[model samples]
Target: MAFDSLGRFGVWRGYTGFSPEEAREYEQLGYGTLWLGGSPPADLPGVESLLAATETITVATSIVNIWVAPAKEVAASFHRIEAGFPGRFLLGIGAGHPEHTGEYRKPYDALVEYLDELDAAGVPAERRAVAALGPRVLKLAADRSAGALPYFVPSAHTAKARTLMGSNALLATENKVVLTDDTNTARTVADPAIQLYLGLTNYVSNLRRFGFTDADLAIPPSDRLFDAVVAHGTPEQVVARLTEHVDAGADHVAVQVLGDDYLPALRTLAPLLAARS
Candidate 1:
């Protein structure tokens, strides 16, 4: 499976212009993949440049919102990348929040249709994944695509997702990490990122499934909830928290380092994570 090539860890970043130098650095540091988030366009605008810049690192979308990026367009983009980079790109698609999507209705059915279109468009099931947060979609991803790439979830959720996905699927969990030792600093780095998801119903519902209460789901987010969802501390301590996802069931953990810059944290954690994975 292409999942094997993903090593044991990958870097997750918001969709933006990828720096060739930064990408090369990620490869040198031993991260197997660079996951682009924030729902990239159907053309997959900056992907080729990223792939061309690095030799072996897999560049994947953390998610391309199905509602925004049509199946055929995304499928064409996938083929274009495959022709040039071959096994270097992975298509990650998802049904974005109803709160944000104007035409959001029957998301599960919509996702099935999108997958069907991708199938007709000739995108291999093995080369794509679904950004699922619930059991039904998780199973859909496992049965129909590569597997689930769930976000805003804890290690406990990883264990449950693994059960639903069975044993052979590529279960890559997205984990947020703040590379700091002090509690205040960690919260300072993580709070802004956490606040956004707290308003999104999908993430809130998922957190509740894992036993978090309404208080935990507040606008500012309770410290207990923040601690559970975001791994924060020293590099070693942060790595220990991230390892929990792998130990629970994640085949690969996509580390989303929260801060002003990602390189410093990536550099510090790379060797430590390489030793563990």
Candidate 2:
């Protein structure tokens, strides 16, 4: 029942980019939570600002990277947010990519150690989640935190994750969407983001697990892989794909509207997604 607080859908954006004004608009559009990505600062004043701007929409970190944001500082910040905003903040933490972390070694062990720190610092397990992609970390997320917030994944991944995490834990999947009917246009708009993840070992490994080959991960990703990872087309068609995620066992879908402008797409899908949820 704790997962119910997240509603059926949320809006995902980079923490440094989205304004507090836009956060209010997301809540108005019926999204239940706002996920701040890009490993926000440990203090999380941006999360606080968004919470202060809105009334009830939950604010979650898509992740605060363990390497960048220390556990004690993040815990103190979580307590600060909880005091002011109460149950509106959900802490999502992760090991981040080895490519990005200079000290990255034994990520699983590091994540376990980070969780131990959070636990000692009094960050309740129910109030946090892990940015888990693989089976081992997914199970760890279920055992330690509230659940899993898996990013850049498809419904098949969601279905597999749900099987690993079981019924009690939260399964909030992050799905990217492009608002256009033309396949070529959609792929062009999404390719930059897709290309970025293609280089990341964690994302690449997860996609490989789901049957994506090295050819699919090449510079210009294959349409099959692109379509599998990103939902595109009319609002209705995109909503249909989003519904597939929900049907596949996601408790909540954090929609990342790709492209320069997020509002127009988010605005268009609000009512259509509302109807489905």
Candidate 3:
């Protein structure tokens, strides 16, 4: 189970600017895994440091968009990274959005074909996962790859996903959290990222699966939508929200700090979480 490979919780913060040594510090600080989400260039050089620095923490691609990262390029990177760091790497690839790239095809078919290429190139299914959010993709993740690494989903979706896939598939769900008491500023910082996802059909479809209406996923994230998926408040409160996800069904709760500066937010929780853990 990927369950044992992960910590009780993981930080899904940015790796956009941090050097690999910095990631090592986060690993030393007791964060089990780092999920790189900003879709950094698909290369092994960037991942090598993160894998080499920490002996235990698993550095994963929260997702590498298939549009930008071809299977051959990813396969080459996989072999290079795995040769050096062994099991410390996990490949997460997904078809991002039809709108973002006008050349998008039948994503499900594309994903399967991509997985086939990875398999042919000797990437083990156990060492890779897909960015999945719906029933078909989730099932595909279970049947083919290691599991699904779903982003921007609520605890309800996690629970439902677990029920659908049972104890077999790895359920790693990312949650956008803020370490603040002020609702307005937090939402203001969060609204941009949230709105960027508003038009993604895959994400919107996933929301609908969880009983959210079209109105719920409009331009700005509604209160019900925000309250359901995003967790805001103190570290303790955020932890409480994470606990709800764990209780519901998630195996790993990857936290994305919902503000401009995530370092302060992570630093605030690091000591307390590390000490208690």
Error of 3 at 63 (Å): 0.9
Q: Which portions of model 2 show Cα errors greater than 4 Å?
A: none
Q: Per-prediction TM-score, please?
A: 0.98, 0.98, 0.93
Model-by-model lDDT, in order?
A: 0.92, 0.92, 0.80
Root-mean-square deviation of Cα positions for candidate 3 versus the true structure, in angstroms: 1.9
Clashes of 3: 0
TM-score of 3: 0.93
lDDT of 1 by residue, 1-277 (tens): 4787888999999889458788899999999989999989999988988888899999999899999999999999999999998898989999999999999998899999999999999999999999999999999999889999999898999999999899999899999998888999888889988999998999999999999998988878899999998998888899999999999999999999988767899999999999988
In candidate 2, position 146 carries an lDDT of: 96
Please give the clash total of every predicted structure, in order.
0, 0, 0
Q: Please identify model 3 stretches exceeding 4 Å from their true place.
A: 271-277
Candidate 2 TM-score to native: 0.98
| Candidate 2 backbone collisions, by pair | none
Question: What is the total number of backbone clashes in candidate 1?
Answer: 0
